[model samples]
Target: MAEDSSWMTAGAGECAPSAELHPEIAHPARIYNALIGGKDNFAADRLVAEQLSAAVPETVAGAKANRAFLGRAVRAAAALGVRQFLDIGTGIPTAGNTHEVAQAVDPSARVAYVDNDPIVLAHARALMSGSGHGATSVTRADLRDPEALLAAPGVRDLLDFTEPVALMLVAILHFISDDEDPYGIVKQLVGALPVGSLLVLSHGSGDLVTPEQAERAERSYDPAAAGIHLRTRDDVARFFDGLTLLDPGLVIAPHWRPDTPPDAAADRLGIYTGLARL
Candidate 1:
């Protein structure tokens, strides 16, 4: 590999998808991007985001809190000498991306971002194309198919399976319904990685929201869009089963080892997050 900016497109082949982008429908990636104040989303995504926000006034703040949690977690992993990252369900790239946080710790860090949406793949390619540092790549792959994702060239190219890797599943697992066997999916991905590897994840929670608010929020994600399935703390904790959970296990997103003292509003984020070692 020539490295340098050349490595920016090192895994371009992995992100190409046969499915076309459906701009008319609301997509999870675009909605999240819009919540984070990114310009990559369409009006459909904005509608869904606004609907959710109206139902749960705290949603926009919650989404930003989730992003902050991601940054803190990635930086913590990087601090622990994790130079490689496999970030699945990586939505539209915004401020504090995984590679940005990891590379801040070590310039040579490598990251492979995976997402199923074609629009996300396109925006990811554009946002990341010329980073000119670290081995960063984007791939279009479904999180449900861990086998295919693990076999993707983008992952195999940018990350060495033999070493300790940080697998990030931030705010994405909720898209998977119970019938999808989400736990099994996590197990398959974690089992493939070497010993001492880490699993870092954040998921949506309905513990704080009223039933009416949760139902209204759910309606925003129509059948055409990726459906949301919020779980409770106990349900979210199951994903970290069989792995050693780090301190402050499975708390609301902003409360997880915050760089600054967490405020009372941090509890209203309506998300749970944790880091675990295999």
Candidate 2:
């Protein structure tokens, strides 16, 4: 790994939003942290998480399943000899981070994590200290801005554009509404990479959740947090367009190459996940 310590010097001013942290508002990352039983979230995040859990009892389980699917996807990519990873929308650093899983499989693996949340970067910096010095770096960039995210110093420093990279979009695409041209966003990011690159994605689905449950969940994030837009399985499958989907294409989170026997309860999580290669 080459030394590009410039990414270290670039502070939040360079890539992060200038707005102050609003503890009163429920952020998607913090709420996800709370749902995963992490202690990094605040009162507002916990409140919204709890409300969603009450409305959709499987919501918590769905979050956990999504994380597990991410780990499995990363490991599978590593097995395929893909060493570089660009994980956009990486929530609060939890147990199996992208760099952790990829590096475990191959020590030389490099990961660039992109998130818009300042708190996530704060925790990530602390977690990365004294570890993964050259192999891992975090950047503040929104998925909506593919050019800025692709050009971010951290991403440019850690990942080689010429090489095969695994682009992980786990549980993050839902925040991007149709108006944002989520499909075009995916294509733009994928287009920058060379052939043989992989796209690993897990998205929230409305196919399983009842209309009432979906309405309640959307209401929870209406004012304070980023709005939720759960798509159908067919809609999510469109994300892998023109790519080769691996076995068990576009299934629920836990069903995509699970290490354990598929749990019947996982089907209720309302998340569609898949791994595809260009």
Candidate 3:
């Protein structure tokens, strides 16, 4: 992708909040970007990725697997006739973005990409500006505040609460610590959706790693803006409470209706994913 010098500027007549590029601090999204072989991150982010990868050699593969799960889940939702998407904690723009995949299935599909990271907002805006799909918006919001996130102008404008929507929380809920009430946050978001809406989520886990590896991975993310809180499979399942999980419920990322056959060790890769209906 070519660098867009105007990415920092909101399009004519648009008023989106701007964020500072704090390159010195490690951000979870940027760290994820680096892990996925993206170029939109900084040295601090790369350091976290390097340290985490060193501790758990499968870190990169796990990240890629999580991303793949997002694509498959989105495609499945689109194919199911859900036309609106509310993708929270959207990381930096990359291949097979929510809108790209959904719109490919149905050009009329609409997506609202929400994230607190300024870099992600900038890139999303740039992506939206050039999008021929026409029904996309980027909102700067934090998942910790579900009410505010649900009411953000971009989200409310692009998505209809009365209609079925696919709420995507892929590879992001792990960043929310228990103190932040991650479950409550998800509940609020889901409750706001209609009965037919779907929740697509993926979370990191420590279940497959030894205590030492988990500790080392935690230490690597100590300086990040949000610390990684790998949850048990049961803990992750709590996020789907009051909702019915779709086919292939709560499996490892690669095993969640995989497009291709998964390797034997795919279950040990540490990311649990599921798609559910309200």
Give TM per candidate: 0.93, 0.92, 0.93
Which regions of candidate 2 deviate over 4 angstroms? 1-19, 132-134
Model 3: residue 236 alpha-carbon error in angstroms: 0.6
Q: What is model 2's C-alpha RMSD?
A: 3.9
Expressed as tens digits, the lDDT of each residue in 229-252 for candidate 3 is 988999999999888998999998
Model 2 TM-score (2 dp): 0.92
Writing each residue's lDDT as its tens digit, candidate 2 over 94-135 gives: 898888889888888888888888777777777776645447
Candidate 3 local Cα displacement, residue 277, angstroms: 0.7
Model 1 misplaced regions, further than 4 Å: 1-8, 11-19
> What C-alpha lDDT values do all the predictions have?
0.84, 0.84, 0.85
lDDT tens readout by residue for model 1, 1-278: 11111113554443244446788899999999888788888899999999999999989989998999999999888877889999998988888889889988998888988888777677777776664646888776788778888877777777899999999999999999999899999999999999888899999988898989988888889854689999888999999999999988888988899888978877788999999989
